[model samples]
Target: MPASRCGAIRRADASENIWCMTEPSAWRRARAFSRGPESTGHRLTRRRRARMRRLAWVLLAGAALPLHAQNPVEVDAQHYRLEYEDKQVRVLRFRLAPGEKSPQHEHAARITVVVSGSRLRIEDTDGAIYEMTIYSGHAERQPATRHTVENVGSTVYEELTTEFKDAASQPPKLVVKAPPPPPPPPKKEEPKKAEAKKKEEKPKEEKPSVAASAPTTPGAQPAGTKPAATGTTTPTPAQAPAAKVQPEVAAAAPPPEPQPIIKPLKVRPPEEPNRRRRKSFAAEEMSEATVNNTRLAFMEQGKGQTVVFVHGAMGDYRTWQLQIPEFAKRFRVVAYSRRYHYPNPSTGKEEDYTYEANVRDLAEFLKALNAGPVHLVGHGYGAAVATLLAERHPEMVRSLVVSEPGFDKLLDEKRAYRSHWARDEIYNIIRKPLSRQNPENGVRVYHNWLAETQPWQQIDPQEQYERMQNANALRAQTVDPTAPAFNCEAAKKIKTPTLVVAGQNRSPNSAEITGTLAACLANSERVTISEAGPAAYLDNAKEYNDAVLSFLGKH
Candidate 1:
């Protein structure tokens, strides 16, 4: 789409081409007669004619430009959902129904992560037709190309396209505007009256027709008829054929119940070995243990009293990848992905995830491991899960370490806020996206806010794209209206020794929340890890691990 690659070069090529046509007779005679050595029209050198033909071909190549002005994601919503976007990268989820064909579209150089199997028939601009079979998790690098697509497989075709936006830059003029025009606002409706009526009726509107105890998507109007979560597919207006034969959406099963606490058990805390640094902490293999009806995947190391690590939202057991190996050298360490996380097969079913559901899953897993008086370490949303479990089943937990726990209750008990609070300003960045029906952007906006970074950070595309995959997990949590709040009084009821790990970059309000939590827990202590944000484990593992190890060594 670069202008120099197209328009400017095309104009120059056209002008030179016209001159070439007009001067062909004169040029032919001159080439055959070289001033004094050669006679006119007697002979010509082959090399010059070949060079001219090559020049014409080069000019033709320069004239090629994008056929239309549209981005692939904006071009096809049902088939392509924006998984992530930052200054450096853009990740999109690509899906297609069997026999469906997409209109010709162009993509920059990208890497595709195939999550499901599909056979595709491609019709390239050069008129070549090719068929391909893709397996799950298959990664293929793609060059910039324009093409139409057809799903030849009987099964659905899905893959993740992670475009490295930094590979090249096009001039502003060459950047195509979207095809769809933005809708204008209605002039007839009185904004104030409509808003006033809605405010009065909102409470009644949010009530649900179906009664269910399962955690609802963050979008669920737990309070009243706000509306179901935004990401759930209804019908998109894009002209592309609607995909049929999607994975069946299953009704959420009831949350697992915590089994009766068998025997009270106590396990001694750690003295970790001072091991050398590892080459890489990326998991090469995983071990699995079944608890409840589901199989839980985990990693195990060391051999002492048990320490189970739980991850926050948009994370799996892998979130603690760096810390687990270090801790395993001293204490028996177990880190497992939560339900619906990587390594575990996707249910393909949608449900609102909640602390209660997570707690039930973890409790059963711990019981299955036969490790009680377990040292519990949780981060962010995982921290909330840990706290809830500790409060409900104190006997199963020995000590608790929660990092930057998120409970709406923290937002509610704000002595810092005057008559007006600015948190909503932060909240609305995400709200605006979700309200405008851009759920993926809403997820990224919230993550950017939490990390205390600009709306988009410049990082490796694969790294960001891998994390963007987690954005799908945040959908339910992002809009869950029925999410539980952090209860200070309930936290006070917890007698298990607790450590609250507060990161340095937290907002004053967040700092207060952690501080208040420490104050409430009768036997709790707070420690701050510098140069870290919501996830210290990821930002600076050694500092985070050392703090955690030091605290555990005492208890």
Candidate 2:
């Protein structure tokens, strides 16, 4: 009970005791004196104060009462039944008797009925008013309303409310304020003349290149390899001799047909350096260095050229389950979950998982397993990771196959739709429960996160749970909104033969961003995988596998 009301009740109790203790005849005899009416006035004042206290007590008691009380007059009876504890609604009934009124309150949603006996008038807090003469069996939808119900009749009134009390219990909610749609992607501008000036300032023939010194063909020798001696005479084969004296031979030799010069075919060497190999999975070999802190759990299979698969956010090596068996037939395939993914305990530190850190981890992992100069294949965020890896460790990557990196650039390009998606997607899913102020709702946020991404749709419920655990660990490492425009310059410096694939009809922004990245690269091209999405690998394993294999080739 409210403290003020409790105090009032105590005062009323004391007053009642005092009245009870006084002998009734004595009290009545004292009340008979009107001369010097001061005592009589004091007695009247005391009675008024006691009555006021009793009224306050009743109001407070009603407010404090549990909603489950059988008394319909209890302030929250219907609200508590609908909002908290679940109850099924069969038929809702409301009854009002003569000369009674309802306390003022707001109704949030439409309900099925308002019935009244005798004449009644409802005045809303907003000054809107309605009058109704209710009878025994009448039923109708209540207005989206806020009001006080009053009885115009001569007797006390009663009210009954019926509603659908049992809504399926929903998980606690979160309120993810949809991020403002990113600004429209900047329009592409043609390279300026100043760009050429910058280009000219730098010396040409930069970096180590075998092609600069070595002969173009395997059998051709470098310029310095053949010594040029002064006045050296070389013997010529005896003149093909007069063998042409015959008429047909004479015609053939008429003018030694001018020899056609054949230029050597120049082939560029692999962009990355070769590294040592580890035992294959079919042989049941395990690397000494673990992917996380645990023993290696990845399967390394087949043996020709090497292809390392990196899974995306909320994914594990199993995401490559279908691709592994197929790709492994023609190439060494190795897939592993990074730390905090699966079979790995999350370190839960943002420092442990920057974009740079992820790339570095892949580098170390490759080194530990004696696998490098690898053809790296990545999906979604994994593509971003792979691109960074190739940029930083160019010597370790032979070629790269990246698909739908899920860069924020996509949302930035399609700002309008992204904004709507964020609101509709996150409001109903993440923000509502959060507005209710419950921390148990964090899990709902994670689930909503998975729902936002396309890949999660293909995963099973058990897999979803496991993936959520990792996402939770990494959630702290959100992209810095103002971080410098993506490090495309860094990525462009990579010379690996890179194939960028985007899924058509998935995320238009994804495709656009993929095109932008490919355009920015020194040796990259983009392709759209028809009818595919973020997890196209799983959606059409054969097609995806074939594309990767074709791009990588035997080398």
Find the candidate with the highest lDDT and give its number. Answer: 1
lDDT of 2 by residue, 1-555 (tens): 123433433454443222332346554445436335775677568778879988999988775432322333356343223322233443333443333456654442234433223446887555566886554235555533445677553222233444433222111222323334556864321232343455457565422222332222111112111111222211111232453233432332223223221111111211221211111222232222243322223447789878889987656566676787778888888886664454333333333555665666777777766665889999866788888788778899999998866555434444434433432433344333323323224333433333323433343433433344444233433422111135456657889999987665444345557766888789886666666655677656667778777888845
Model 2 off-target regions past 4 Å?
1-297, 347-351, 409-459, 469-472, 476-487
What lDDT is reached at residue 205 by model 2? Answer: 42
Candidate 2 lDDT: 0.50
lDDT of 1 by residue, 1-555 (tens): 123333433343342221233345665455445544543322235346767888999887665532224577767665888889876678888877554678767787788887655568897666667998776568888877767798755345678888766435221223333444446853432443564465556554222322221112222211111112322221111222345212321122123444422211111111112323233443233454445544455667789989999987666666776887789888999888776554343322235455677788888888778876899999877888899999999999989999877565654443333101223333434544544432546655555545532223443333333344444455445444344555688888999999999878664446767987898899988888899866677777889999999888887
The reply for model 1, stretches above 4 Å from the true place, is: 1-279, 290-295, 347-349, 411-443, 452-456, 479-481
**What does the lDDT read for residue 256 in candidate 2?**
26
Give the candidate number with the greatest TM-score: 1
lDDT for predicted candidate 1 compared with the true structure: 0.60
Candidate 2 global TM-score: 0.43
